[model samples]
Target chain A: MIVAERKPIDEILGFLSKHQKIMLLGCGGCVTVCLAGGEKEVGILGSELAMARAKEGRPLEVVQRTIERQCDFEYFEGIRHEVKDVDAILSLACGIGIQTVAEAFPDKVVWPGVNTKFLGVNQNVGVWAERCQACGQCVLDKTGGICPVARCSKSIFNGPCGGSQHGKCEVSADTDCAWALIHDRLTRLGQVDSMREILPVKDWSHSRDGGPRKLVREDLTLESGK
Target chain B: MSNGKDFQPKIVAFCCENSGWLAAEAAARLELGYPEKVELIKLPCSGKIDVLYFMKAMEKVDGVMILACQKENCKFLKGNERAKSRVLQTQRLLKEIGIEEDRVTIQYLAANMGNKFVEIVQNMYDKVRELGPNPGKVIK
Candidate 1:
C-alpha cells in the first residue's frame, strides 16, 4: 500500500496560522492503514490545532471529517457541505488525495499534512520500507521475485555487482544486497543458469521519465457503448 | 510564577485501573496526602486515553497527567507503551500551540507503589505551579 508519514506539527501550524476556521480532512485508505492520517489522527490533529490556537488568544474553529477514501471523487460529495465555510483544508491523505481534493475545490486552499513516502509494505506495527518503485515494469520473473530496482542501492539489473560483499551491499553495512537475495533464491530453485542471461537496458519510457502515468479501461468506461 | 498560596492549578490525572487507580486508592487507604487540585479519572487502561481527551482536559485544566503501569508491567501487556506514545504525540502538539510540553506528562508505577503516586502528583503540582495557570484555560 502507499505509505506516508505526518509532516511536523510546526509546519502544519505555520500553514494554519492565518486561518481562523479550517477543516481537517482525513482519508480511510493507505494513510489510515499506516496510522498517519485516519479518523483517529484527524481527531488528534484537530484537537491540537484548536488548543494551539486557543492558547494564542485567538481560538480556531476546526471541523473534522473523514471520508472512506479521499482518492475517489464519489466520497468527496459527503464533505462538500462541511467545506463551504472553512478557511482552508488541512488534508490528512496521501499526495494523490490532496490533489484530488484541490481539483475538486479549486477555490479553497488545500494543504498536505503528510509526506507521501513510497509504495511499500509494513515491516512491523510502526515500521515501513520501500518495496516497489512503480517503474511500470515487472522483472520479478527473472530476478527471483526480489525487486532490484527498490532494494538494491544501485538498482543493478544483473547479478551481484563488485560492491556486493558477504551478502551485504557496499552502500551500507546494514543493507542486504538485492542481487545476493536473487542469487540465493535462484540457486534454491535450481535456476542458477537463468542468472547468467544478461538483461537488456530497462526502458525508461514506461516510467515517470516519460511523464505522469495513467491507466484507462475502455471496457469499463460508460461511453464504451457495450 | 505565582506562589503556591495564590496559584491553585487544576490538574487532571488519567489513571489506569490496574495500576494507577489502584495506587491512588491504596494511597487514600494509607492516609497519604496528595494535592487536592489533582483530579483522578479512572480508566480501564492507559491505552484507552485518547489525545482528544488530553486536549479537552488542557482546555479546562492547568495540566494533565497520565498514570500508567511501569514498562512491561501493564496488565494489558502494552497499554502503558501505547499511552506513552500518545503522551509524546500530545506533548508535541502542545508545544506547537505555544503551550509548555511540561504541562503534560506520563508517570509509571506499580499498584503497590502508592507513595510513589503521591510523590509524583506533588512533583507535578509544584512544577505546574511554577509554570502558572494554563493560558488556554477557557474562562467559561
Candidate 2:
C-alpha cells in the first residue's frame, strides 16, 4: 500500500490561516490503511482545527468529508456540493488524490495535509518501510524475489557494493544489504547461476522521465454524453 | 442544562467484550452498584480502539477509560498491549493541550470481578470530579 504520514499540525494551520471556511477532504483507500487520511483522521483534524481557532479567537469553520477514492472522478463526485461553499480545501490523500482535487476545483486552493511516502508495507505497528520504486520493470524473479532497486541504499542492480559489511549496509548499520539478501535467497533456492546474466543499462525513459504517464484501456473508454 | 453550578464531567468507558463488559454485566446482574457517571461502550477487543476513537471520545467527554481483560487472559495476545500504548499516546496529547493526563486511563480487570468493576468505576468518578471539566470546553 502507499504509506503516508500526516504533515505537522502547525504547517496545516498555517495554510488555513487565510481561509475562514475550509473543507478537509480524506481518501478512504491507501491513506486510510496507512492511518494518515481517512474518515477518522478527518474528524480528528477538524476537531484540532476547531480547538486551534477557538484558542486564536479568530474563529473558523472546518467541514470534514471522506471520499471512497480521491483518485477517481466518481468518488470525487460525492463531494462536489459539499466543496461548493468552502474557500479552500485540505486534502489528506496521496499526491494523486491532491492533484485530482486541484484539477477538479481549479479556482479553489488545495492544500496537502499528508506527506506521500513510498510504496511500502507495514513491518509492524507504526513501522512502514519502502519496498517498491515502480521502476517500470520487475527483476525480482532474477534476483530471488528481493528488490535491489528499493531495498538497496544505492539501488545497485549488480553484486553487493563495497559499502556492504557483514550482510549490513554501511549507510545504516541496522539495515540489511539488499544484495546480501539476494545472495542468501538465491543460494537457498539454488538459483545462484542467475546472477551470471549481465543486465542491460536500465531504460529510465519508461519509468518517470517519460513525462506524465497514463494507462488507457481502449475498450473501456466511455463515449461522450453517455 | 446548568443550574449555575459547575458542569458535571462526562465520562466514557470503552469496555472490552470478553472481560470488562462481561464484568460490567455480571456486576449489574449481581446488583453491584457502579456509578452512573460512566457510560459503557463495548468493543470486540480493546486493541481495536484506534487513536481517532480515543480523540473523538475525549472531545465528547471529560474523562475516558479503556477496560480490558487481565494481561494473562487477552485472547488476541497483544490487544491489551496495543490498547495500553494508544491510551498512553492519548494521555500525552491531552497533557500537551493543557488538559490533564489523568482524564484518560486504561484499566485491566478480570471478567468475574463484579465488585471490582464497581470499585474501578467509582475510582474514575472520584478522579474526574477532582479534575473538574475538560479544558477544551468553551467557557462561554
What's the i-RMS of each model? 2.1, 2.8
Model 2 segments more than 4 A misplaced: A52-60, A209-226, B1-7, B17-36, B44-48, B75-78, B92-98, B111-115, B138-140
Q: Give residue A180's error in model 2 in angstroms.
A: 1.1
Q: State the lDDT of candidate 2 residue by residue for A24-129, as single tens digits.
A: 9999999999989999889877776665665566766888899899888777777788889999999999998999999988888999999999999899977998
DockQ of each: 0.52, 0.29
Candidate 1 colliding pairs: none
- Tens digit per residue, CA lDDT, model 1, A11-123: 99899989989999999999999989999889877877777677677888888999999898889888898899999999999999999999989999999999999999998
How far in Å is the alpha carbon of A117 misplaced in model 2? 0.8
Best by DockQ: 1
- Predictions in order: lDDT: 0.89, 0.84
lDDT (10s digit) by residue, model 2, range B7-113: 56678899999989999989999998866668999999999887677777766577889999888779999898999998898776665556788988999998898
Q: Looking at candidate 1, what is the lDDT of residue A87? A: 99
Global Cα lDDT for candidate 2: 0.84
Real A-B contacts recovered, model 2: 0.22
* Model 1: CA > 4 A from native: A224-226, B1-5, B30-33, B50-52, B70-72, B96-98, B110-116, B135-140
